[model samples]
Target: MAVSTLNVQKCHGKNIEGWSMSITNLQAWLQEEGTVVLGISGTRKYVDSVTMKWLIAVLYFQAENPNAALSFYWEPLKKAVRVEGHVEKLSASESDEYFHSRPILSQIGAVVSEQSKPIVSRDVFIERRAMLLEQYGDGSEQLPRPKHWGGYLVVPEVIEFWQGQTDRLHDRIRFRRPKSGDEPDGVLLHQGDNGWVYERLSP
Candidate 1:
């Protein structure tokens, strides 16, 4: 298993880094505490593993808050990969599959909600949801996923890890994907072997 960490406060920065681990532990961590920092049109958000399974693709984030920043984390790949490129939304079929997999109530809610739009009252939303449910569901029929709801895939350009230490002497490791065939200079650790480079940063 591997892990990735990004510091959103530093800007819309992302990194991917992780150590070796068993597949079982990897799945367990993902099921338990897996999380990532995200940015969308100036609003930085934190998407836990559960929420992330749905919103996979991460578009560039630009939080309206002046202090906001965006971050992304992932781990343990077969080969070294780079992030920080164009973000891609999921395909319609992919979106549909994900949507159908969600709870019926979630589908109904997403369909009924106006998203970021302001609402007049909770009662109106409740009424709309009830009506939509009555029309689309009888408990057996699988509801369709909302058109506006889907996932994003964030391919990171750099990967980093931070370990807190005594008195703020923390240990930070980073892996930056090379722009050219020439790999970056540093001691690269690859699958118990050396294939890529990783730099230790002063905290």
Candidate 2:
């Protein structure tokens, strides 16, 4: 058996700011339920433009093995992105190699950014960035991926695709697990009309 529910809410007179706020509120609500997975669509340039493009990040409680969940979700995301004409996964060695390939300035930037979080002033960050560049400017590959800076994979139990239509009649298709079954095989497959039906979602 599969269980699902649709929630409809009106956002009358609420502007874009309000919509953004509502998303935060919804995240808080979902967190209370259990682990909540999120997906967001946006241009890469748009994400790269901002100092932090974390608007769409998966949130789950701090766990003993947080990396486990991340690894799970990351696999399918890599596949989905590839199917949509994007690059595929980077092996651990590949990831390490890519880190070494980064420019010295970029490596310094990563270091400086990690030390300066929740920044309030632009000039301060710029100065710090410049200072790091100068300090590490021998153009050496000594810098490594920051201890806190790495990728996490999330194994999604459910994936939902939402398409907007006129008059606010959106199209939503969710895939979840059946109430009774063995664990999903975790194989990603492309399906016509159904899109990617990798797993069954609990409706």
Candidate 3:
């Protein structure tokens, strides 16, 4: 999953800020200056790398051990889903609610580590975790959520489904918001629900 900060304009293109976080059953990270590429498949080439704070984000899901051969020497199909979207920062109250719901140890980890910053050694985290554990180990004490910590919501504008084929003519289907002057002729582009459009692309 890709996430970007809201309200901070023009982060350095190379530096992306993020930290590992687990909520409920999902684990994700935040990227400060993430890049999102547009125009996956079509005649019009849009090869620009868009680096913006809130304009782009992607959620990618890939299969595990897809390259390995299956039973009877059959090759397994490699599949992935990519979603690109606009990012919106969650409200402070919402952030607080999610923060407090985390396990105590996870909460401590978030507070102990300063993401994208340099530290002399891993022992820094070990020591800090130990100290915090001693202080807030009991249920009586609660670790306060850091003001800088929060969450983001990625509203998808485009989504692509990909499947690898043995002939290398892999299948790709993209669903996205209809751009201005888009007309589905029912062959190359098909009209979809809620002002969306779908198209099959050449691999």
Candidate 4:
């Protein structure tokens, strides 16, 4: 397993950096702890006045980069899944249930870290964590979920599957909602189950 660092600049000036983990661990972490930093809180004030359209894309690697000192000449074979969707915030009750379901230490950690705000040093988190531990001395009590901390459900609009080939001829199949009068032509577009259509793309 290889450790990779991901740095991303989020909307509203929030940033994630120095996060290193194996691909599998990172994927799991993003589904769990990463949700805490999702930008719903920073834009809450503007939400009332503006139309909010929450969109999200999730990418997964099936066959990853080969482990080698030099891989430039290696076959570009790969497989991946890409999901694009609209997001809907979970209800307050749902969020609360999920938050409390976590381990006590994780709950406290969520409360201590100030999401993406820049910090002066590691001492900031250390001090904050120490203080929180002292306040919640015993693990019997559940920490209240912060207003900004919650969950979202992604309603997939388009899902794409990709496979890379050594001959430089990759394959891509995209599934999406079908338009009115849309019919599968077989060669490029094909009819899929449940009101969906799939089309292949040129590599």
Instruction: Please provide, for model 4 over 47-140, each residue's C-alpha lDDT reduced to its tens digit, 9 standing for 90 to 100.
Output: 2111111112111110111111101112254776554544445567977887777777777776777654678998998888788777774865
Candidate closer to the true structure by lDDT (higher is better), 2 or 3 = 3
> What is candidate 4's local distance difference test score?
0.49
Q: What residue runs in model 4 are displaced by over 4 Å at the alpha carbon?
A: 1-40, 43-77
lDDT (Cα, tens digit) per residue for candidate 3, span 6-104: 111235654342322111112243343222211111111100111222112221111100010001111364876655665445556866787887899
lDDT of 2 by residue, 1-203 (tens): 11111112234754222111111101111222133222121212112211111222311111111211111113333222101111112234634555566677766665566332356777866898787666667865366655433322233445555444455554545554343544445553323233334432222
Worst 10 residues of 1 by lDDT: 22-31
Query: Stretches of candidate 3 above 4 Å error?
Result: 2-77
Q: Count the backbone clashes (under 3 Å) in each candidate.
A: 19, 16, 1, 0
Candidate 3 lDDT trough over 10 residues, lowest sum: 62-71
Query: Evaluated with TM-score, which candidate comes out highest?
Result: 3
Displacement of residue 150 (Cα, Å) in model 4 is 1.1
* Candidate 3 or 1, higher TM-score: 3
TM-score of each: 0.54, 0.40, 0.63, 0.62
Q: Candidate 1's residue-wise lDDT over 1-203, tens digit each?
A: 32222323222464332221111111111111122221221111222221122232333221211111123333242123222322334466856775676677877876777544567888878998888888777766667665446644433445566655557686667665554566543355322123435677777
Q: Tell me how far the alpha carbon of residue 203 in candidate 1 is from the true structure, in angstroms, after superposition.
A: 1.4
Ordering by lDDT:
3, 4, 1, 2
Model 1, position 149, has a per-residue lDDT of 60
